[model samples]
Target: MKNSTLLLAIASAMLLQAAPAVAQNNVPIRKIKAVRPTTELTLLDRVESDTHRKIYQYNEYGYITSVMEYNKEAEQWVLDTDNSYRQEYVFNAAGQCTARTSFNVDKAGNKTTEKNKAEVEVIGDKTWERYYKEYPDSTTHISEAFAYDKWGNCVEEILYGYDSYSKMETIRTYNKREYSGPVDKYTDNSNYESFKNGRLLYYLKARGFDDQITMNTNELFVEEFRKIVWQTENDKLYRREYGLDRGMDIQVGSIEKNMWKSSESEFTLNADGTRPVKETVRSYDETGEVKYDYTSHTYTWDDRGRLLASFEYNESPSEVSYKGEYTYADDYAKTLSLREAIAELSCGNQIYPEDEFLQFGRIATSSYYYAEDGDKGESTYEWNADGQLTGGKWSETCITSEPDTDNPTTRTDYGETRVGYNADGHMAWKIDHSITENEFIKIEYLYDKEGIWTGEAEYDGDSWDGPWTKEGERGNARARKRLATRAATTPKFIDDMTDGSHNIENNDGVWNTNGNYNVTDGVVTGGGYQQTLASNASVPANPQYNYTDPLMPLEGEEDEEVFTNEAEAVWSYTWNPQKGDWESEWSPTEAKRVYNKDGNIVADIYDGNQTIVSTITYRLDDDGRLIEEIYSKGGNITYEYLPGTDYLLESVETAADNSRNVCHYYYSKHNYVDPTGIESIKRNDVSTPVWYDLQGRRITTPTSKGIYIVNGKKVMVR
Candidate 1:
């Protein structure tokens, strides 16, 4: 049986305990206080990763103020200086977070000023939160305002775009649900809607107060509608949907689900009330009616409540059926305890939900069988006393049957992985072996005093090797350690190479450094000489970036060097007073980029000295996919896409030769934003008119006037 079925059965048993003590089938349960969100991040004791580690530092108010990343070197944690990634938070006197800022360090180990990349400001204790993003020019890229209901649910959200003349808003309204004791059903009937440019884009209206049925094993009321939904498009009516639930009475060994027969779902819990033995799942047609096909599952568990075996019965003959069995370690409890102890010691602060203490045990080995022509697989796990999952091995065999032939063929494959952990429970060594290929790979790890993983080395061979070592040739490994707390430090030389040392000088308790460069006191100060690496790959070699006539490379397109090829390109810029930034426009001396209203790259201009070298302009279809690209160098490409779809490329045509390439496209599902929040207008492509009702159904016609989603936008039809 699927894990979900077991979870559902457990949920049903828990519900029975809600009845009066004398009438309840199970013993009364103790309730634990829920953890508050504000203190959750600060309460973490420690977090360790192979290459990085983040230590949460909190203030007196128990609010996280700074998150620092450290590097592990020589078995100790050291301040990482190579990567520029840090977050600082501020909280008000009320202990509520007031603001947060993120910063990054560059390859040269220069820490940018705080609040460089993005920031969020919280206002109005319980009602609203505002967020902001900062661009390279120290300007706002976007901002958002959110309003919350008493239940801490976001009820209204407004998004403000920085560069485009567009706005989006979302509003949600909810009603209190009625109580009917243990067997009663309730609904919030929350209404949600989204609008773009003051036009409705999406909506959902859900209603509640449904009659709940319970199964008595004899005339049992076993089904209930949690809520019914109505969906519409362009104010046109579409389809309706219902949310269902199956209730089981734990007192009696018998269970009946979906008694009302409105939806298709049934689950049965064993009289023991601890495990689920069987479950049935049904398919539904687009109209919300149950289909004839269904699936059944049966499960067997050990006396300790651990699932030992499971079987799935498929109603359809075309699909393969599944059966799996599990086993536990001989000393399962002792091993589990040791592992838990190591975890507790490593974290220092081990706080888990109250329910975790009573959770089920882990599996040691598992085997699976595919009944359609006999395919099988199995895996085994190994662990250490430190609670580390040391390594695992898996093997699979496939038996293939040929049509009209009595002979059957088989193939087998297998692999194994072994891992060793450090004293802190961090994985320090790993070796992988593939029996089919007769190949083996090994990796070694190193850390600093702070338990931050800072180095790694790898080797591959046909024969096995010894434990990890530090003297082997390095494998793309690097590390940088911070020297002081926001103070200038002298540059150091390691192996005669200038170490990329940069520092954050404290300016009135605010750590500040230039962004992507060496700077101090709000000035561009030079440190170790910096130079931009030129691209080594030929301009036309990189198909992903090189565009023909009428199509220029997008900004930052050439930054990626596929083969570490670098060539320097001369560049100069003209200042744009209007935008308060240095940019190349009228008298361009370097490359420049321009974006259209929908934020798509519209054009790229390349200038040499005072003359224009080349120009590329891109045209996009209504769905935002590139339809045509024009390059000044003499050639262009035009793209043809299917209409009324996601602009799937149907064909490509080159202007030079008129040669055509065609393709067929398929998609799993259309992407649509939920109505609970505003979706940014990233692409203003034209879309085919489609209608939908609040129930999320596609409607062909409108039966009555109402609010509906048309082409992903809201419309009111009368």
Candidate 2:
């Protein structure tokens, strides 16, 4: 991430406006007190979409060894550190992450480990995204860029996935005051806004997505939004919103009551004027199922609020309570396992929930909590001088401890991609990458006069490697293609490359030469990349699905499946050359395998060739991991793919004496059997896990070992 793009000066200007500013009662700021968020979830959309995040760290402390996490559904403790994360901390003589990194976790039998740093990058007034594990096959990174405004409203933010897929498979931006809600539906084209000078202004993008409604509803158009103060005989304040959904004209529909508005709405400033306060808000469903509710808040003393500790709650009568004395120590913040945090929150020990809507059965989206009975629990906290929490870990993986291995030998390299940026700080980019063990790659950008990226190239651990031609933009290179006859036997579209051939050397010490296999009218053809008959194979990530022999498509079925590269198909008959007409004698075998010009098949043909005739050739993923297989018998070639061993296919070769060769043995270090009685088989290569049996014997003893039951304590029988 680049600094200039974040615009620190703009943020400073807003906070430094000439208008009289609200000041905290002259109290010396201690460590930043507690900080809170509107809504928080362990995993967004409740999905474990982020499975391969890595971790990293810096600043003179050899502090945390690793961090891990368990999801909300976990019955017990779980680990989180499976990816690379970075931590930045300022230390005194003792090397504690004074300004950053604060959290802790609990160990099994009885010990507690602490973490003082998290993945952080502080540079100038802005912190760039650092401590990220580089992905193979990707020149652009999947990242979150942030910019804070005067009132703490996010001024600018971008979330994007930068690999080649669809034009907007990645890139989402959240702009405050500067833009309004997206009037479109392309995630990459979405925009948001704040207000300016009493007039409605917007953070706008001609291109981007606008939030859409479900099936039967109309699309809601954003009218206006932003925060600002106004004055008169009596100072007043408000958080305004403007909206429209299709046929309706734009109008102010709803708002978060009495905020930093120019005039007052429904609340008042008490004698304790600037002190922190909580205002509970509510919303309910038709059945009064207590759908939603949450406490609105204003932090009191800068660093004294406990953003992580949830206040107590009693439901039947409807009551909420917090702000209590710590039972055992001067310090109450502590780190716990994911389960520990949930337990405290479940009971009344932590998180402050505003109870105004107790009758409605609704509360704020996020809350905080600390441990209950022990000085030895899980969880940790960090505070700024004013006693405010800048940021802290949720689970240990939030500020975990793990062996450092930021630089990995493996990485992905998806070819070249272009990035586009709008004036409001919105960005869109495509990326090309690949995964290879023999090398590393860096993405390079080529810009046009407008400073927009028109070109993109790669540094293959060596030099700037540009693709052969430019796509549409200036510096980006895209391969060109031609759509041939659409009638019947033509492959969808042909990649009109100048020249090329498939030359592969097999274990038999033979370098096979390949040629084209294009179909024209009724004859199954040949022309381009060289491919053989018996030993050729398919490729991955991108593959061309072409039929070896033309066959009539199903009656009236224009489309059978989505395709990347397709050639016209035909019918196989018993004429002189053994090929004939449509319907009467033609039957369709759903496309199982696709091929390239060199006569070699491409992509995974798993589902297509499931009928399984005989021999097949396999195709690998971007990492050479087997993805599919293809089979051919003259004009009757078909493709098939199956679950495979990571390295090679495992099969039993019947020997004359009845002996079998076990080709592969998979291993799992983080192996765990779930409630379904099935054991997961991924590698532990990082954090270590434990397993137990009915008699309390440690069962995860390395070798796949003896017989083990499912979730029920396994009785190991040798």
Candidate 3:
């Protein structure tokens, strides 16, 4: 997510001011402590996984002396020489970090040092920092400096180039007093301040781009934000006075005509400080007859502080309000306990005895868009006790009154979808049905013994009887996306039980029954199971589903699936520079896979540098079931699943690659037959007596309406 716009400096200034400033304390400064991971889970597609652990050697003063990688085969920690990485920290006599060096190391254990230094100065509450990086290439050298105020607030920054000319400078100013709470719910566009001392007031930046010089300034006012006023001014030197001809006066006039632009916004707030309920923004044009009127935006939120609806409108005659409403599977009313439920219904007025209300006991059951030529729609959802989404429906009536009598009086269409999950809680199958025609499509997902989705297939109807077959130029790509339309529209929203806040807010015992899908904290370490391909096929094992047409099809060739193996084969990926992530789609800097003697892909190295960025060594059991995966980065995860089921028995993780932290796996006796039975024991521990405020302070009692901590954990006590 790189910002290409030159005005990025203004956006960055806004971001810096949004965060509150931290107050400068007179106490001894706390040195940054080195962070070490106790557990890491290797991601499937990315080159770097959280499971890859980097161990650090710390000096007596708690500063990191060296960092090393885990060596799998040797079962030892080694210096990071593969990428030629080395770092060391230097401190002044006052114990303050003064300088740091990061260079490279060759395979022969020799250092390739470069001149990189960072100078720091501190006097009372003020500080200064200067950085210099001189690489072998002179053009690569970088010099930057920063100044802080008495409250440790950044006041200025400067950047210098190899030449005598200064590249850029940024200056910042602050408000006289820190803002106190009861903040306006509307018109408050200010950032969440980080400093307890003062709010940010202005940001001024000057930079040289190519041969042109430009200046930008942003000022902020902290006047309760009942009304917001925003302005932007830009000044530029078209050309140096030494080079400009007599026509320079005319160029200067043109620049002045478009020198600056300004805007203003006003807003109204809800009872809570979540966000503005309504806002209006207006822009000004100085040089043209075209005048811009105010554009307004409105929003609505649920009791839980989640946005439920929103809309926008403009003052133009042709413009109409566009609105949308979001509905969740579980609302605040449905998540209440039996006791609280009765109290809510009674509204604190005892209409009848509480016992009578609970006599037989128990149980139960649980958007709009607009224009004058109007389209109306409604959406509803279904879920199980565990808050796992099971089904949903959306219907819309485009034209309420048909223009022609021969056509249907009303044009109404509906889309209904149902989903099924595997034993491990991962999506297994989904059916999308067109209610009007009774036509439906089904997609089945295939996975290995570890429950990682490997392949997918789509059928024509609710049952696998109807298969979708295609013969075309992009047959392979189309086959991969047979169910693409359905997957693209699948709702990412989860039910209340899956919201993570449910357990903390509702103390009444209401257990989740959706199976062990997203829950990972209590996953006991241990075990290995044989990977097997089940003979069961969602679709018939007929001639249609297979792809035995050609080993490598010619360009623009047309071939159909004749008989492809049901088991998922190899995997491929591409890097998406725009997203800064590796994607399954093709990319320029993609990795190439090579097969080993065992016919397994052992390495995936980058094409440009041939660097072994990712390596996966598999250890198969007698039955050829993948029992272990050895990563080049030294971290390995072993899996064991229940027979014939995707449910895992145990997954043992190493603190680092081949670290001694590996522990023995054990199985405890249980009454329930499956892994879901362990949910009782996996519940979060809440035995200790502890309390905390909304600010995360350990307090004796609650003093505000926000979140609170009790029994050593967060729990909403309001």
Largest TM-score belongs to which candidate? Answer: 3
State the RMSD for candidate 3: 23.8
- Candidate 1 positional error at 516, Å: 44
Error of 1 at 615 (Å): 21
Q: How would you encode candidate 3's per-residue C-alpha lDDT over 257-369 as one tens digit per residue? A: 33333444544545643335655554545432234546466767566544456576758534656665554544533343322322232232111212111212211111555
lDDT digits (tens) for residues 1-718 of candidate 1: 1221111111110000011112110101110012233322203323344444544433333333344556668877777643324555554565444455556554343447544322234355335555556545555543555554344444344444343333222211222221111111111101011101011112222221123222112322223223222233332222232333333322111222332233333434445544556555655653556776454666776766655777777786334398878776543432223223212212221121111111234447778787866877776767667445566776778887776798898988787767676666666666767677775667565453345443344555565564332222222122223333223433321111223434322111111112122334543333322211111111222222211111111111122453332232333343233443334322324643333434334444445543446666666656655666667765676654333332232224355555443322221111122223111111122243476887889987656645567677654343
lDDT of all the models against the reference? Answer: 0.40, 0.27, 0.38
Best by lDDT: 1
Candidate 2 residues 297-389, lDDT tens each? 322221222232323433221344332112111243343322222223223121111111111111112223222211111212233343232
> On TM-score, who's better, 2 or 3?
3
By TM-score, is 1 or 3 better?
3
Q: Using lDDT as the measure, name the better of candidate 1 and candidate 2.
A: 1
Task: List the candidate 1 regions with Cα displacement exceeding 4 Å.
Answer: 1-93, 97-127, 131-143, 147-157, 160-265, 272-274, 316-320, 330-362, 392-394, 401-406, 422-430, 441-461, 464-718
TM-score for every candidate vs. truth?
0.32, 0.19, 0.35
lDDT-better candidate, 1 vs 3? 1
